[model samples]
Target: MIITAVLPALSKEASIGNIVLSEIAEYKDDKQISHPYNEVKGAVLNLHQFNGHNIGVIIPAYNEENLIGETINGIPEYVKRIYVIDDCSTDSTPEIVKRLTDPRIVSVRHEKNQGVGAAIISGYKLALEDNIDIAVVMAGDNQMDPKQLPKLLEPIVEGRADFTKGNRIIRGYWKGMSKWRLSGNFLLTWLNKIASGYWNISDPQNGYVAISVSSLRKFNLDSLYGGFAFENDMMIKSNILGIRMMNVPIPARYGKEKSKIRYNRFIIHTSWFLLISFLYRISNKYLFRFHPIGIFYFTGFILIIFGIVLLLFWPVLILGLVSFTFGIALEMKEINKSQLRGL
Candidate 1:
């Protein structure tokens, strides 16, 4: 198979040079089948030119003492710098990160525990100040395989996407991930699809990702949430900016590394955060940031409001919920949740 050949080359180095679309046939995503691959091939060709580019990888750690070394060790030599942000760990995670002697690796310790989002933002800011062409995120727990790092960068390097991430929801890859994590990621990813205009994107929760500097400045990182919501929320922000975001399917490797995420917390947190992020992105992009076909949205909104006021004041008016439903249905159609979820 085409991927069988390309996988070996890609795994060895971040650059899979001279790869043709035909060669990547085995990795051809069915979701993308309708889009054709000439675009992807062109992007791949462009990706080859980014060798020797300045790159920074952000490894955010909490209590990941058992796995931090593997993450630091597997980083490709070509990366310009590695930053480990220790979010006030109760364990030896910060000490372990400080022990890494790679000249390119820098360790930053927060005085108190900040959320994953804060750590990532801090890392990205440092990377940006360093003037790196690309900024990558690979968690300290070592769930991300270094082999797929190049693939995540390919789309960004090729100008196909300003941001790209690892998508573990290949259905086949679900086996390697815990059922709880997998299910939660699926829900959040689906919600993200509805919130952001980017559709058919898989695995929004996979933190293994790369972003172009252009994409970084477009977001006000300080305003985003500080935990798991960060990833999904960032995608929504990117979509609002008309920045292209895509995913490369990657196999997940979850081991004994303790998951900082708890299901009950995630459920309560993700629900509230998703609603807030969706509304913020929708308001900014459709209402305040940029204007598209929002004349209809406002008209529909006003109609629903008027209908509600009329219905409240007069029992003769029965069209309140109907009008409100019309606006909501149109909004949902515009966002296209089902399409984005790859249904």
Candidate 2:
């Protein structure tokens, strides 16, 4: 496969080297399997010097001066290019990138500081322009494991899915993540399931991801949310576009990397974002795509709204709550039925 890894790096000076080198080791382990494929009793299914595939790494940096150089140096020699996007950093991020002498490194700068979503978009556009077949995303903080790239790419390369993402909450892995972050991610995942209709996906906030070029082009890049909600926003878009998606069980990795997110602000903004996006999806799917079942979501929403508004009137409140609950149950049943039929 023509593979490209996109790293949305920030101020990762302390940990970037270890993460990058880990990717090299992962690539070496992959190269040892001569056939690279096997037949299972029930089923089936990157970057070092052993393989013939062209590889690229895109690192979008913002004020990542201390770690950007180490990050770039750690890419395996087999990688064909590394695209570094500087998003108007007030620090020396650009100069650090410019000082790198590796022929594989290519730098792009944003005139202003956009969010991580925008930085990834910039990297994605470059990967597309470079004609890469598969584009993978890795956060600059080094929280994502480099060894798991193979797992993320298997479904896409095998034509089983168009998009694949990491699921940090799977198989009891949440025990390692911070309690506050874990709770927030779970809540966001629940909300995302309702809005995006991807009941199967978890860890909605995990940024480790991969997408086929064909599937990536199907989205309107300009319209994607440019904040922390960007990953969730992409899930909603995937639902709207009918992209086949799956999640890989990956463990959470947290260290000295300081988070730039403010939970209070994030909660308010992301709530509004999802609410508006959900409404837009309802309108688009029902009115435009012609999915008749959209009425279920609307009915449930309206009843819930009425129930909250009539809280002072005990009789109306009780009646409204019952009806709202029933509406949600019916909707959920329908969704389950659709899944059973393989819709």
Candidate 3:
């Protein structure tokens, strides 16, 4: 039952405090509280001591000198160790981490600047080397609330799931989230649901997550996407491995941390990434593999395209339309049948 938390930060000195021991809204009634820490601490204390569960925390920092200490200090005492990965920050992020008095803190520095995903992958490698049982991902900018972590960890600990993530869309909590982000989240989530074959999860963009070490080892870390699309890339890989993923309801917290994302670029870049990943997923899941549904899905897509191109030929257009409709019907039927089978 050993658990480790991983935090990825990038130039977030202003916003990291918003996440540490942050106020969490009660799922039942939306009542804000500051003591998810107490509840989680108590739960850990009550676990069977003989089970030997140890919790380790990891932080990936890149030029986050202003708020790294606050982020590290805010972690609950129940954790066994904190790994801070300094991804070649131009600032004094590594120096700041070294000055921390907590003996559990371990700093790993990268010689060059890699993206956040690479930093996280590096930390994952370290966690695996040390044989950490379960690794949790938290952000260095403090967007992830530690109080709700138990919800994410419970399924993995109980052997019900290999990976778990936070879902901020439940209960219509999107009111506080930025409208642009809300739209992007919805689009990406829908695409991810189809691509990953994990229909139960929403808010696929949510970074707060916990994954079993065994599952992490199954991935080729070097091949994963390195930018903001990294999380979405992980989901696709997880689906390929047939690992179970569960989503826990968690509220979104926005604060002083200025987002590095540019809306136009994010949408354009991520949309392309998702579209390509979706095609790759379909190919791997159906065409490359022996799955009946994949045949119908792709046939339907191809027919639709052909139908548009052959509009001048009335007979061919009619035939393509009919074929496309039938293909879509079969694909839908198989999707429903698969869901029932899972149940």
Candidate 4:
């Protein structure tokens, strides 16, 4: 005689261990099952290996005392190093991390509060110094799921991409996100596509990301934007360097954590920075590189300005619009050639 056991449905916030437990429990209830729970869990958790590559996780934290410990604890055992950059947290964040006896943990505290971008940069610098093969960025708020980290690392590990980022917009994974923030993200996604020349990528603002340290060595880290626009700027610079990027579908998790971003100010400031960066990309990638695409963009803008300033220039306005459209199409074609899709 066989007895069947009932298991509760796992929620979106369920961890890998919990999910594995549920699966193992269900299998164990069947008479035909043979694998033990610990064996199954170990198999699921240690699914990925980077050969000899060293993987380092960078956790940029700011007063994340409540959830920081959980975030650090959730990291997989395969990770070689965990760089926690405390941005001068006023709380006991530093103390809590210190209490953890994990030898892999490297605590770096700023004398004053640097922005999140600055903290990540510090981690990147250290990773580069230590010859880390891959560096991943996860928020200290525990919002990024460790279960999905392998998704971000796979593309880079397989030599398919130089950079990989978590895409929360796919598969309705973003349903857990706040509606207002989702709306704002939708607007920025299109804007970022144009500015960064990465028309195929989505969820440009998602901070859960992984980068090949070799790619990091290609650009000047100090030149990157030091605030919320940092991720957007990374996309722009990566496109300029012709770096291949892949988007991994990862679900968004919202718990008791509150966002520190002020979207009203963020939108205004980031939009302006994107515009300037767009002009720079056009100039650097096209004009400086002797590509004719820049002429189309410049002439289009000049004609549009003249068309608006002078009356009876409607024909010039139409020509300007067409020229700009051609430029954008050509740019997208060039960029798409190097873009990689999710697994």
Per-model TM-score, in order, reads 0.72, 0.75, 0.76, 0.82
lDDT of 2: 0.65
User: Which wins on lDDT, candidate 1 or candidate 4?
Assistant: 4
lDDT of 4 by residue, 1-343 (tens): 1111111221212232322222221121212111221222211112233666678899999999999999999998888778888888999997787676554566677777878998899889878876478999999999999999889888888888989989999899999988889998999998998788888799999999999999999989999887889999999999888888888999999897889999999988888888889889888888777686787876776788788888849999989988877888888777666553423
Candidate rank order under TM-score: 4, 3, 2, 1
Provide the overall lDDT of each model, using Cα atoms, as 2-decimal numbers: 0.66, 0.65, 0.66, 0.78
RMSD of each: 13.5, 10.4, 10.8, 12.9
Q: Which pairs in model 1 have colliding backbones?
A: none
Lowest summed lDDT window (length 10), candidate 1: 1-10
Residue 288 shift from truth in candidate 3, angstroms: 1.8
Deviation from truth (RMSD, Å), model 3: 10.8
* Highest TM-score model number: 4
Ranking by lDDT: 4, 1, 3, 2
Model 2 lDDT at residue 6: 20
Q: TM-score of model 1 relative to the true fold?
A: 0.72
Q: lDDT for model 4, please.
A: 0.78
- Residue-by-residue lDDT tens digits, candidate 2, 1-343: 1212222211121122222211111111111211111110111002342134344455666777666776666655655556676777888877666665554454667777888888888777766766356777776555666667678777777777778889988788777787888878877888787677677788888888888778889999989987789898998888788777788899887765667789778876787888888878766765365544566566556666776777646655566566545545654565466444433
